[model samples]
Target: MRRVLLIQKAADKKDAKPEEIKKSFRTMGVTACQQMQGKKASDVEFLVSSKVGSSELLGIFENSFHLTNYENSHKKQPSEEEQEKDKEEEALDKDDRTKRINKKVDNFVVSTENTSVVEDQDYKFQQASARATEFARNLANARGSVATPEWMEHQIMDLLKKHEGKVGEVRVLQADELQKLGMNLFYNVGKGAISQPRCVIVHYEGNPEKKGEVEIALVGKGVTFDTGGLNLKPSGYMEDMYGDKGGSCAVLGALQ
Candidate 1:
């Protein structure tokens, strides 16, 4: 099956109807617009699996898009109370949307009628990959203050353990362990500045028969939370700091 990832702006109004919101997506005339604001990546999988339906379209609206490589638009900073309230409201909206998205993904995964004989062999890999993406998102979406490096390490370990036999191996390099290896040299301003940094290494063979070939190596930075460290971010700019671990998220999703 083929897949596509579309990133679009979130609706202007939170209460906008799905159909109206769908129309606002900048598809550039690709013709796949079914109107879904599901934030999780799995939603894309579902859309592609269904052949984009008879209408040949799907729409995904995203509200939070942060750009580190380019100039970002400036906005007036809201008060602390307003920031907290917005965060809470966003969380609630996310929870509701996730529940609906998962229902669709679960239904798609469990349905066996569409599977072909050849697809059976790849079932485990598919499931593991999807689970990895889900777990990574969980970590990324975790409450800001709670998603520390140590906490994220524990979560990754737990997720890997759940996929035991299917994956070749999983290992974690603890903060002290990394320091001993002089990995601190690679970190900014030395590792002493950041406390308890950890790394998770997942080994899952893409082709079992070619084991030990070691054809590719992937690296991802798992910064559980970025509080701007020494140079803190100004008021409103710091709200979405939890997404600093986005690189690791992509790695986790690609591993399976």
Candidate 2:
């Protein structure tokens, strides 16, 4: 990961070829070679890397290359008009590609929407009803409680089933593994609850052929409700803690 460069000057007494300069560098334990451009003159420049300190490299650079005031004459300057033309060309190319891809996507999306309308009616209606009922119940009885209802596990399972095909496996982490990973934070926070704390992982594969390629990961801290614990909060603050599960809901929504 570290890089060192040794610049050598051209021979003065005798004109040296590029190959000869390269061979000379190899003799000095330079294992890597990099080509460089001379700043002052049209002479060729080189960058060589060796397992040597900067001071040692500098000494080699000075001794190998002859010092000369050779000014570079091949500097290229682009005209304003040429630069503008290149920009216009690039923009046009980008716009054309965007239009083509968008057209294909629009057609496919329309077809998919039409197909779903006819085939997914029954399942969609059932989901809509379930969601409505869940929403109404949460809104009506929004209270902070330490006990986690058994029904929450069923809900989590349902969520996992809904996203099973999209995301590979949904598994709860064992207590020992959780402790080893120092995830006692969740256990500590949820200790007072009647239900024991659980950590769940939702694994997904974006590319099935490339098994290990993980394009995305989503982690949700699902603390159903908070009562401020030992450091008790004001009644108003505790009331709002009932919505601590909002982050969990958001992640489920996005995955769906």
**Model 1 spans with C-alpha error above 4 angstroms:** 1-135, 166-170, 185-195, 226-229, 232-234
Q: What's the distance in Å from true for residue 228, model 1?
A: 9.3
CA lDDT of each prediction against the hidden true structure: 0.49, 0.45
Look at candidate 1 and tell me the lDDT of residue 251: 73
**Top candidate (lDDT):** 1
In model 1, state the lDDT of residue 76: 46
**Local error of candidate 2 at 234, Å?**
2.6
TM-score between model 2 and native = 0.40
Per-model TM against the reference = 0.48, 0.40
- Weakest ten-residue segment in model 1 by summed lDDT: 61-70
